[model samples]
Target: MSETETIYDQIEIEDFTFDPDTQLFTYPCPCGDRFQISIYDLQDGENIAVCPSCSLMCEIIFDEIDLQEYLDQIS
Candidate 1:
């Protein structure tokens, strides 16, 4: 049987690279919301994400996600 992933274990920060010119990285979040977090705020395995679109904040420590899916949407 396939294992089920819980909300607390289904997302993560794959890419946190920032553009020096913009100093901001718009990450594609799969939680029905988009996050435009500062590159400085993005840390490996760290949660507490600040969503710019919805303006809602959340965190993720062990949330796993399909990195490619988000990468495709990110620009």
Candidate 2:
């Protein structure tokens, strides 16, 4: 199966909490742990956020321009 087929859901970037300290975006996962993706990964054009405690993964939906704007603000 493809990566797209493995995605549990599609979550908006805004729905995640951004931690400037770690530059990680996180969201609550059904498995009781958070799903996480790094800003660097996003910058590298990666959109999948994974739960470290489980097999669940989510596709993050965001615009490149919007991500840049957010990064500028945090920086």
What local distance difference test score does each model get?
0.46, 0.89
- lDDT by residue for model 2 over 2-75, one digit each (tens)? 74558889999999998887889999999899999998899899999999999899999998876876687577
Clash count, candidate 2 = 0
In candidate 2, the residue pairs with backbone N, CA or C atoms under 3 Å apart (3 or more residues apart, or in different chains) clash, namely none
Q: Residue-wise lDDT of candidate 1 within 1-75, one digit each (tens)? A: 113422222234555433456645545555676555544444344455556555455443333353334434554
Best model number under lDDT: 2
Model 1 CA deviation exceeding 4 Å by range: 1-10, 30-33, 42-47, 58-75
Cα lDDT of candidate 1 equals 0.46
Query: Model 2 scores what on Cα lDDT?
Result: 0.89
Summing lDDT over every window of 10 consecutive residues in candidate 2, give the lowest-scoring window.
1-10
